[model samples]
Target: MTTLTRPLLVTLVDDYDVVLTGLAHMFDDYRDRILVSEIDANAVLHDAIDIVLYDSFAQPESDHEEIAELVANPQARHVVVYTWNFQPELVQAALDEGVHGYLSKTLPAKELVEALEAVAAGEVVVIEPKRRAASAAGLDWPGRREGITDRESEILALITQGKSNAEVATLTYLSPNTVKSYIRSVYRKIGAESRTQAVLWGVGHGFTPDHHRIDHWLGGP
Candidate 1:
């Protein structure tokens, strides 16, 4: 007798219903490799899902907290971000938030399935390594080489934008607690004791809006 394994169950999440529907169709031919079990902005998994793919379209930075929440979901074993934006900072931020895979939207349907399968098998996959490398090379913040991560720099830049913690939470989709934690880490790295001082340090160290284009990419006001 031979044992037959079940297909990997997947959930597709996106703000747009059209995107969810399209993704479901894209995976139709890969029924053996994976099953599109659920498709909705708020995907409620009735059963355990092997992978939860979050489509960011063009706004990857704004979805970080959502990705973190999905990764922490009880029903989600693996979480992947499917996006057209391959900005290194966004990719690094997603990975730091526990996203299992970062795949380009331009990937062929078959390749996307394979990447998801790899993620389901406990592998971290990221397409567009060249772009990621280029983005990383451009991260020359004053404290970046001193151990501050890409995520920290992003939060610092947000602070410089005069965004309150709650506003930051809304923009970054992170909880207040998580935003505060990141703030603490940023403060420690830059040796700032207050938000005002941190903002000053960020301004003085080149963590400015001109350098951090997250707002532009995310279409923020």
Candidate 2:
């Protein structure tokens, strides 16, 4: 009988030789079922690379941007950020820039592997709650868009605008309580917990802050 391989290609991009070595060992320990590649940021794009787990500190901004654009291509399945001292907007920026998902170095390696496998299967491994909050934060809605109502869409628009609940209420002339309700629905739809994550979720689903869009919110533009 032939052995069917696990349909995932994993890449490790880190500047620290020690970290890379340790990651290599961990991947190797996983029965080699996962194909692991140790790569520098300069490496050319390869269709076989399904997920890229890269270090934020190792590469320069230019190189990182190049890598991000490359990962944005259809060929690269996902790119997970692994580093400390990440700014609030880093993950959302990555999603906007076209990467798949974000993970911190502090998370367990096994969960990271699972996330990679999930992304490889063409399913987004989400990290936020957006649907619930979206409805609560009523801002203003666009003409036509996703299945959500115009009012719900407006909340999303305000969310993408980086407006807090209080801000949304003030801008839309809605009670803060109503704004909070819309935000909760938004969170439920986007699977985002925090406002930043909801913004990212909005971006991830192509739901611009145009008073419209859907999906479990990850990040936004």
Q: Against the true structure, whose lDDT is highest?
A: 1
Candidate 2 C-alpha lDDT tens digits along 10-39: 666654443444555555445445666656
* Candidate 2 TM-score versus the reference: 0.48
Global CA lDDT computed for model 1:
0.66
Q: Candidate 2: where is the Cα deviation over 4 Å? A: 1-7, 58-64, 72-75, 126-221
Roughly what TM-score does model 1 have, to 2 decimal places? 0.55
Provide the TM-score for each candidate, comma-separated.
0.55, 0.48
Candidate 1 C-alpha lDDT tens digits along 150-215: 456556767887888988776666689988999999889888899999989877875553311111
Candidates in order have lDDT scores of 0.66, 0.55
Question: How much does each candidate deviate from the true structure in C-alpha RMSD?
Answer: 13.4, 16.4
